[model samples]
Target: RDEGLHPAIRIALRAITDFAIPFQKSSKLYWRYFLVPEAEFTEEAIPQITAPVIEVKKAKNEVPEIKEELQIIKTMPNEPREKIEMVISEPKKEEMLTPAAKEPLIKNPAIEKKEILPEQILDKKALKKEAKKPKPKPKKQKSDKKEEGFFNKVKERLASKSIDITDIIGIKKDELILKVKKEKKEELLIAYNKRKITEGDIIEAHKKAKEADLPYSILNLSGIPKKIQDLIEALKDISSIEKL
Candidate 1:
């Protein structure tokens, strides 16, 4: 032979017969999804094949499998699982001054508030010291005392003259005319004569006496001495009296 086989291998190659694959006789390791069997159809079974229904069978203890990328690992049945602990870190004291993005969290207190004062917090001692300070009394002027004295004297004199003091209106500048009836003037002279002489010659001496007809007659209203000279010189330097 031209090949490397001996002369006996060349004679055995001439007796070959079948080379077709036997799928039914293959091992289980050689199975594939492409080899699944489909339903056959005949003329009588064509109507049943046109509307075929599919049913899936499930096991009682079947658990759904998860993909390997989810990082889940399977362990032995007697192995214990470790406890997962979480760690939360506290922020530094310096970082709290200027918070993140210069904005404060809603749960944090932004500022401290001052306490308010209660009512009725005033000092009682201060109020008592102010109350103990003496208030000034008003002093009376000298002119007021003099006016009161003159009014009292005038009221006493006018009240004793049988004159209604309320009717004594005012002074008329010491220059107004006085009105006296003639009979009253004669009676005034007679009264003056009685004040001067004895009782029996009093009525006769005034009838022979020369008459001085005056507008007014003052009959010695002062009960001190009943003198005609004091009546003429009474209250000479006094000015007009004022009303209260």
Candidate 2:
């Protein structure tokens, strides 16, 4: 049994030795080929990194000194100069006047020699009195003759007949003014009622007559009835009544 166990342990020891020998040899080769010399690497890297840091520190330290120099230049003073000389001028003297220059001379001999009379003295009061006097009265003007009534003409037109229907219907507002004259108003009323004259017709006639500038007095005497007159008034009051 002891000899069998011994054979297994010998085999395990041999395998382990074989692996260690190759690993050690490879490690030595890697270190010798790839790792550079410490002194040479440090010298090159130190200058590259440290040089920029030194320059930055020097610039920071010098900045305050440069600013101090600039401040000294700004605080310096300017120089003074000599005063300028001033000259003043005196005023000129005026020339003296003679007796002939001081004496007055007439511009126009004729105007200076002219004489004044008492009558030539203007009477301002008399002139004002004349102006204030009242003017003479003008004669009254004669007025134009008034237009004749339609009834007057109608009377002649209906001479033979007692009354004519056409005359009544045709009687304009102007003819109605004749009612003021000779009691003709009753005759006009009779005429208007006999014809059965409408308020609308009378209003239309009045409007036309007004447009023509016919006198109001003439329209008043026109033979239209009192009922028709009332109708005209009512028509005027009615808001919806058109001009006709």
Candidate 3:
């Protein structure tokens, strides 16, 4: 009657309680306290074991069936079978002297093409003329000029102030060439000074900007002259350079 427990467990408990051994029967008080009545348990239970009934089944021999099949196979008449073979021979290519069929055996197109003489395909006069004719020189490619930026004049003016303009020219040119917003450029310069941005970082940022279809040109710090770098280093405050 315990709904919380499995029916199989309840059935097992009931079976143990109902079929009492000599010792269990003698202990009336213990059985009365612990044993559950069979009527209180559910009839539905799993495979039960009571008496051990062993069934011995004799194995059937398949030898008689096999012998019968063999006899049937032997009684069957022998059927005649035909063997097949294939032989292929290429036609001999011999010159025919007869008026009809005088042409040689038809050759494979690939073989005929390989056997063709160079003289048959090329014109001797044309080959000689081509050899004698001078080859025209490759024309030098002129690079397209880039449009000058609005700050190009300002960059050039600042660059002229440098004692040796050769080293500073590249940096000046980059300043003019960069297409990024003025604020972003200032931020990059600040980041560059702080070592947050490197040459590789600038290049990678430029690539990412280009991929995103943004107008930006990266600066190459290494392109600046050592003299200009030294001058900047000597300067007490770098913020003053931002004015220029």
Ranked by lDDT, top first: 2, 3, 1
**Over the full model, what C-alpha lDDT does candidate 1 score relative to the true structure?**
0.31
TM-score, one value per model:
0.18, 0.17, 0.18
Worst 10 residues of 2 by lDDT: 83-92
lDDT of 1 by residue, 70-180 (tens): 124323354333311000122224533433413422221333355655433355656787899898867567655654555454445545754333222122222111122
For each predicted model, how many residue pairs clash, with residues at least 3 apart or on different chains?
A: 0, 4, 0
- Model 2, TM vs. native: 0.17
Full candidate order by TM-score, most accurate first: 1, 3, 2
True-structure lDDT of candidate 2: 0.38
Which prediction has the highest TM-score against the true structure? 1
Candidate 3: residue 189 lDDT (0-100): 22
Off by over 4 Å in 1: 1-91, 99-136, 141-144, 166-244
CA RMSD, predictions in order: 39.6, 47.7, 35.8
Which residue runs does candidate 3 get wrong by more than 4 Å? Answer: 1-27, 30-193, 217-244
| Overall lDDT per candidate, in order of appearance | 0.31, 0.38, 0.36
Worst 10 residues of 3 by lDDT: 82-91
Question: What would the per-residue lDDT of candidate 2 be over residues 1-244, giving only the tens digit for each residue?
Answer: 1111222232332233322121112112111112344333322233222235655677579779767755565556652211110000111122113333233332334334567665555576678878999997774343112223344554554454443322222433333322212323222222221344566655655664465454222223245577967876887878784676
Give the lDDT of residue 175 in candidate 1.
13
